[model samples]
Target: MVDHLIIFTRYPEPGRTKTRLIPALGPEGAADFQRQLTEHTLRQVRSLQQRRSLRVTWCFSGGDVAAMQGWLGSDWDYQPQAAGDLGDRLIAAMHNAFAAGATTVAFIGIDCPAIDAALLDQAFHVLEAADMVLGPADDGGYYLIGLCRPVPELFQGIDWGTAVVRQQTEAIAQSLQLSSHLLTPLNDIDRPEDLPLWDAVQRQMLSVIIPVLNEAGNIRPLMEALQQVPEIEVIVVDGGSQDGTAAIAQTLGARVLFTNSPRACQMNAGAAAAAGGILLFLHADTRLPHDFPTAVRQTLDGAHVVAGAFDLGIQGARWGLRWVEWGVKWRSHLCQMPYGDQALFLRAETFRSVGGFAELPLLEDMDMVRRLKRVGRVAIAPGRVSTSGRRWEKLGILRTTLLNQLILLAYHLGVSPNRLAAWYRDRNFSK
Candidate 1:
């Protein structure tokens, strides 16, 4: 039989979800707890995978598929939960599963952690003798529902979210002459007292590398922000900053390394010292998306994709800044190219095999992107990375834009990067 498992869940947006638990956990706390439950449930799914070759589907609400993939990684087929009551959504999910060639289907939520791999296997085994299997929750509702075939009528006209939910389902099954089996009842942690039962889950570490030159004013705030992210280690590579940038970064608790090398060389040095399995090359004045960790992981998980970068968002009030953002998006998509300011990230092994960023003062990001494209596809994530607009503000948008295009053209026409670097230093904004 085409065994499929569908998980119903809501994206943990604060104040919008898990409201019943807010009084005890607060808004953000509730959201955090919801995320913890989601992760715990996923680990159990992984354990189930070790025993069965079942298709896993995520019937999600609150966020788009991209955001879901960014949060949970690119493993499950995410389908939007249908509109209406809980019963309506369940009916739709069951219908979708059967339509996709599933001979048997099991549905669940993140509410109960007691539904382990053994419990899931028992549900399928019960399906051999019964048309339906139900795992009753300690609460009035059930933790899980499974069916050997589509039984749409059994889901109709039930009082969802009530103690009678299990009873109603049983009555409906009896009316339809469908054989049913009941598994052991599990608990759904709705009250404050249930918090003690949660198991700890470990997340992967992300190593962020930033190459700086005389950015003392900006380094502290950037490090402070990066410090708030759990399991993230920040590496600041300073190229002999005279403005005490290294001192500020070190004081801010970042792992600081000194290098007399250029931008590409400094980045390479930082990458070599990183302890994480994944490496993200960030610009000194750029801010990554909030869900950066998940986005980076999911994008790299795509088939044939080895590296990825975010779209560019210039920070400015000028109307031309909007056009600049549009241009950056199109360039990144149509060109499959992104600059260092876009915050390029990839697995450590992939980067090491490619010999890291090339040692060049100018067009190094472009050169790296060109070489990377030869090995695998590059994924450009949806959210834009906000970068400092000081360059455009100082040089005027038109002049700054023209200068960048001309420099790129010259580099394409076989001009040496050393020559380009000299030209850049002479005309660089002296702010």
Candidate 2:
């Protein structure tokens, strides 16, 4: 038996979709919110599909099939919403699903951030014994409605967008003596006051962006470790690696983006492609602590903290590395300057506000930290990210330390980034 899940959404055109949120989020922002919400909802649906036998249909308004496919990919069965009120459209979709031989059908809107795979699976499970299942929303409208069979009368005589939607639907079900199950109530994002619900959801989502060049050796392990963290999006931006780094990351289920070789350019590309509200800039060879997601959220939640990074832990037994770690701790806390190896992170909005990482070949991390400090405090998380010690081990620690300080001093002395980059490369190449 085919189980069908129908998702109702708009095309997210700036002035057309999520119009109620325009005053608070502006047209473009509201559209972006709609886009994110729809994508988030689909992610849960996809997760459910992985564990169950289900088919999905995308019922949309305000866009053509090509446009919808372009935005959301062509994997779904796209259907243009029938012309009528919300109730009419619901019935039409439900009728089509049953007509197409679906044994169980569920309809949902992309307004509830709390909807997840488990909740969705439970909805289908309830239909085994119950005639109908509805996920109640705090605003009195239901976020989800599922049925074992088509019940057209249930969609009739209800105020679609009012606070009485769920009440009326339940009353209809009671009058018909139908066996129905109501799931836990959740809040939906609709009004300006509802923005906080979406914001809270965003706080839990972290996008880890790794810029790489010929890093196939490190990409696999880094990706494997990252998969353990929940609610994180991994984006690997490859700077035209010849070692099949992009292919490896893609095979590991990480989104891969190809861009120019400059680290800043690659990082910026990943950020632009990211869908999460929080962005973490990571290195290919660095491994985050097990509790990195929690650490990231807690640190960013602090008052006056606009950006943050983890403490540096180099992977080696050298006693000198302890001194290096100690130096980093003080510099990060006192000077508020933690270099990129510590794994810098901040909100996506804050990153855009600061104009993203400067596209300099040398000292881009320092430049980014300096700019972030101007807006608010840079916090150092208690957790540490262990990075490879190849750089310090390849060159003597003392020589590398001195070279780094000299480059910093030269940057402060107003040396052109191009000149600094050339000099730095020359020094590294010189045995």
Candidate 3:
């Protein structure tokens, strides 16, 4: 005997599920409304199930198991809706729930906005005195239905989409001498006039933008690691990589955008295309540390810091690399500046307001830091992001360190970025 709360919804296809509001919302808006509604309902049920002793399921339509998993997630039980109209499907679902040993089963549609955990609990409590529970809709239909056991007669002989649905069902209950209870009337979002219910509520997402030029070897692991984070959206901005970098990143579920532009320009384009509220500029060969989100959130929550970067951990055994990492930490803390290899992150608004990265091919990171400091302070997260030491391995530690310092010196002394880039290129002439 188990309590099961099921949400019956469509897989959010445009021009199909919520067609009534298309004139006002357009096809894209209607689909977004349905998808958000379904997500909101599932979140509510998932929260309730975490503390209570009940199970949850999504009895969905318009998509198969794989498609549903891609759209939502594979964290809950899912069942395909049976063939026929809405009434037949609802009846079949109820009967199946009872046959599967449910003590009390409640189901609601994606349309209703008033369904909450308390009302669901009330449905279960009312089941002790009543055989069935019905949440009437203001449009004369019903938004929610539940039962302690399968009642075949209550679902039959009633026109489903008609305004007299609730009335006819109540009449049928009276004739069969079955006790029933009516929940509060709800107005489901079914027409163009009801679009204001979803307004001004923001969804916070973090976009992890990685700029790559022929980094096929490092794409997979980086994408997988970022995918583990909850609100992260990984993007691989490729700069004319002949290697299978684009294909590999897409296979690993990271969005890929191509450009022949420099790393700074590619990063800016990726940031422009990102749909997240925050932008985390990562290197293609970098691996982020655990608890990175919490660190970033705490660091950025302060009024002073408008941008932050993770501590640096060079991925190499050479003891000299440890000192290189120390140099980065000191520069970030004392100078309040970090290069892009440190996995810099900032709010999207701040990034845009800073005019984004300059189109310069070199010193773009330092250039952005100077401008960023003018607006607010920068911070460093406790967690570290490990970057590949391939560069250090190619050029010995002393030589590489000297070259970087010389480049920074030249840039500060008013050397043009194009000239610095040409010199930097001459040094990294090999693989």
Put down candidate 3 lDDT per residue, 1-431, tens digits, no spaces. Answer: 58877789988888887889889878887887787677656545643654457777788888788888766665667899989877788888888887878988888887875576677777777877787899999989998888888777888888988899999998988898888889998888888777554441212456789988888888888776765554356678999989999888876656678886688889998998675667889888888889787787788887889899988999889999999999988999999989889889988889999999999987788888889999999989888898889888998888888888998999889998888888889877322
- Which one wins by lDDT: 2 or 3? 2
* Candidates' C-alpha lDDT: 0.84, 0.89, 0.80
lDDT of 1 by residue, 327-401 (tens): 988888998898888999888888898989889877788998898999998889768788999999989999988
Ranking by TM-score: 2, 3, 1
For model 2, residues 1-431, the per-residue Cα lDDT tens digits are: 68899999999999999999999989999999898898788668766876688999999998899988766666689999999999899999999999999999999999998999899999999998999999999988999999988899999988888999999999999998899999999999999998888878886678899999999899999987875554567889998899999887876657778899689999999999888889999999999987888888899999999999999999999989889999999999999999999999999999999999889986889999999999999999988999998888888788788888888899899999899889978877321
- Least accurate 10 contiguous residues by lDDT in model 3: 196-205
Work out the TM-score per prediction: 0.54, 0.75, 0.65
Model 3 misplacement above 4 A:
1-203, 429-431
* TM-score (C-alpha, index-matched) for candidate 3: 0.65
Question: What's the C-alpha lDDT at position 79 in model 1?
Answer: 97
The better-scoring model by lDDT among 1 and 2 is 2
